[model samples]
Target chain A: MPRISKSDVVNSTLAFITLILFWFLGFWLSHYIALPAALLGLLLLFMGLLCLGRVPKPLEYVSQFCLRHLSLFFIPPLVAAWFYAEQLGNNLWLFLFAIMFSTFISLYLTSWLGQRFFGHSNQSVSQDDES
Target chain B: MTKVNTVDWQSIIQLVSIEQLLWITITLFAYGLAIWIYKYFAHNILFHPIVVGAILIGCIGVVSATPLQDYLIFVRPINWMLGPVTVALAIPLYQQIRLIYAAGSKGLLVIIIGGCVAPLLAIGWLFLFDFSDPVKLSVLTKSITTPLAVDTTNIIGGIPELAAGVVVITGILGVMFSKIIFKLTRCDDSRAQGLALGTVSHAIGTARAHQIGAKTGAFSTMALCVNGILTAIVLPLVFMLFG
Candidate 1:
């Protein structure tokens, strides 16, 4: 096992607290606003705080690690979905076809427009790519 | 089923909460096995861990006669973690702010087009098929990430479960097929590829972008965030106007 440092532990704890705080904020706001909007609102607030406070190294590490492993977080809902799978029994084919078709169409159109208009001239775009 | 009801099983059940422990262990083991399978297969898009993990878990449920309600008792913690995980996305969005600015008006245009057309096309076609309102509403937010898609679906009076499932399906399709689409279009620009994937498929698309390059991942994150916010706000309003 890799050695765990005290600062790393502190950072992870702080990151956990930050996420919990935003989760509560989202819960509170979900009563008034849509849940997505409330969650997004909380995310933006977190971002603003990070900027104003100058993100700590530990927070950065925790967030990036969490984001990279984001799929793990989705496992619960995906599994819970088993409960409602039967609801989709009707028109399931239509749902599948429409979703797949529209997704491809959206992908094609967005990329085409992005390629034509964006052109990747900006230095930041190049810098990120190189990194 | 016989195995579960066997005399030997009765003794085991009396000794402990066999059903709860069995389901919990099965869920975790399924996820681990799925990841191993995904890695063994070289991360083939079709072998996506969630898809395989769900299948494996479902099989266990069927074979053992374990009810979904019973399984959920042990699985709900993983479900609740989604709230904090959703908030965790802020870190990436914050890091990618500079690139978001660099994409500029072009990024805005792609988002506007994707954000509007994705739902319109999905819902319009479903309307023609005469699907119920809830089904149409469920599929409308299919292109966004699951967290945002479920929430948006909830507010718009759509079925959250259906929305979540469709979102995952759309994401898998987007990741699996994007290679051919990108090749046919000769879309060499990483930003464009990332934006397209992020807009259509959300996190899975971003994961694919990461595989291709860092820049693609960065731009994809921007696209994911923008597309999510747009859909979350736009879908409900559109529904209100024409629902």
Candidate 2:
């Protein structure tokens, strides 16, 4: 099994604090624009990382933990959606049609595009790396 | 008839005020049960974590006569953390910058087309159904990951909850049908398969893609981050201009 790199308590806590601070920064920016605070936080952090030209070890370590358990976080929202279930149910066919049809189309289009445009080239590059 | 009438959903409203701890335990346990099921079964699509956990929790609520509002009081903290986690998504995105650059204009073009056109197609497909403007707007963000989709949906005057629900559906359905879609489209390349999964299905798609292979997972994650960030950036700006 591959080793899991665990950050110490201090680094993880510091990383959490940094993320909260960035979230606050993004929240503040949202008031001046028509966007979500978290997304602005994401964009700001993305730019910051681009400037640094590297992801900090602590941030990467901590974020992976958060992302791994991301599904658990969503359970409440889905359950709470019971209140709106009536509306969703009424439009169930429309919802399913749009969601399934569009998703299939996009997946099909993207896979075809990716294969047609970059398949051979990417394969060659990986082959070179292996050699 | 008297027993049935007296035991209806409304009666529970006055019967008891359940503690938050109980609900939290139930939520966590449901999630644990889902993990156990996956470990034993080696199946994913039919039993996606969110679907399983949420359904179990919802079932518990119904049996306990607890409304979703009360359940929310217990799990609101989890929902609130989504914001910080959204910020964390940038970490993986940052890690991918080099790979994306190395992959060049071709990768960029694929991500851009997949990300942009997929959501638009959803909205176009919505034209067949006569939803309100706000309902129609919600579909715009459904192709992205949930947090970004919810946030973007809110900013664009759509229902954030609806956006989130559809995002999950998109993820599950995208993975569920990917095999057939790829074959029909003649997209035999593994890398492209991963990219399509991540680009259209978001997180759930990435998880399924990872199950396929590590290289596929990497490309899927790459597509996920780029598509998520791109939609989050562009959708809001486009709505701002429209208004």
Candidate 3:
């Protein structure tokens, strides 16, 4: 396990504040337009980084940390499953079937489409074996 | 278990409610434990941390008769911070774009098709079965990331909570059967494999893609972002015109 050092704390704090600024800015902008605040913030950050031509070290550290544990954030809304109990119970099999069926269809469709669009490029095939 | 229940959970909730920090710590600890279980139990995707943690929290809520709103309140900070976290996603998104300049519009085309196809198929399937409009709308948002799902659901009059739940299930199902799908289809291109996972499965699929390899992770990240942004922007407009 890698222990977080003092510098780690400082860097994450800085990264966090930067993200919050973007988040706030996005929220403010979303009032004028009709985009999701987070999406707005994300685009702003991306464009800002594009201008910089590189990710800042602190931002990189924070983003990696957040993405690694992204699943944690989803758990709260997932508790809504309890609220979904009544509807899910009545259509349990149908619900599962629809979700799984649609997922598989989408999954295979994308995979096949990916093949059609990207599969022919043998030069980039080097990525296949390395993974 | 009976003795555990003997303690007045109501009073405990009241006491803990006074100091929000206590509940937040407990919530994080539950999620951490869920991850530990996933790590120790042969790493089965079946016992996904999201699933297990939700179950644990549900149990606590049910046993105490705490409403979902209260639990949400207790853990509100986590939800509040999601804004910055979601914004932070752009770093990885931007970085991946730079890494895979060769993919370019070809990659975007694949993602757009996949993103649109998955949701349309889901909505059509729901219509065939005569599932309610809200369920159909929620399912339409299922293939996107959770945050985007919430936003899209809100736009289309779907239940955001249900949309979030459906998104998780979709992602898990994506990770669950990806290997079989890959083998049956013989999709050997890393870009293709990653794009399929990211576009169809969203963030969860991207996580699985990362486990496959660095190149795959890069492509998957690109697919996740492009597919999400496109879906978020285009779906609402389509609904306005046709819904």
What's each prediction's TM-score? 0.87, 0.88, 0.89
- Lowest summed lDDT window (length 10), candidate 3 chain B: B1-10
User: What is residue B124's positional error in candidate 2, in angstroms?
Assistant: 2.2
Task: Supply the DockQ value of model 2.
Answer: 0.48
DockQ of each: 0.50, 0.48, 0.57
Best by lDDT: 3
Considering every candidate listed, which one attains the maximal TM-score? 3
Task: Rate residue A79 of model 2 by lDDT.
Answer: 70
Q: Local error of candidate 2 at A76, Å? A: 1.8
In the range A19-80, model 1's lDDT, one tens digit per residue, is 77778777877667544744665466566766686666666777677666666645656666
What's each prediction's clash count? 0, 0, 0
- Kindly report the fnat of each predicted structure, to 2 decimals: 0.59, 0.72, 0.72
The lDDT ranking, best first, is 3, 2, 1
The TM-score between candidate 2 and the true structure equals 0.88
Off by over 4 Å in 3: A1-7, A125-131, B1-16
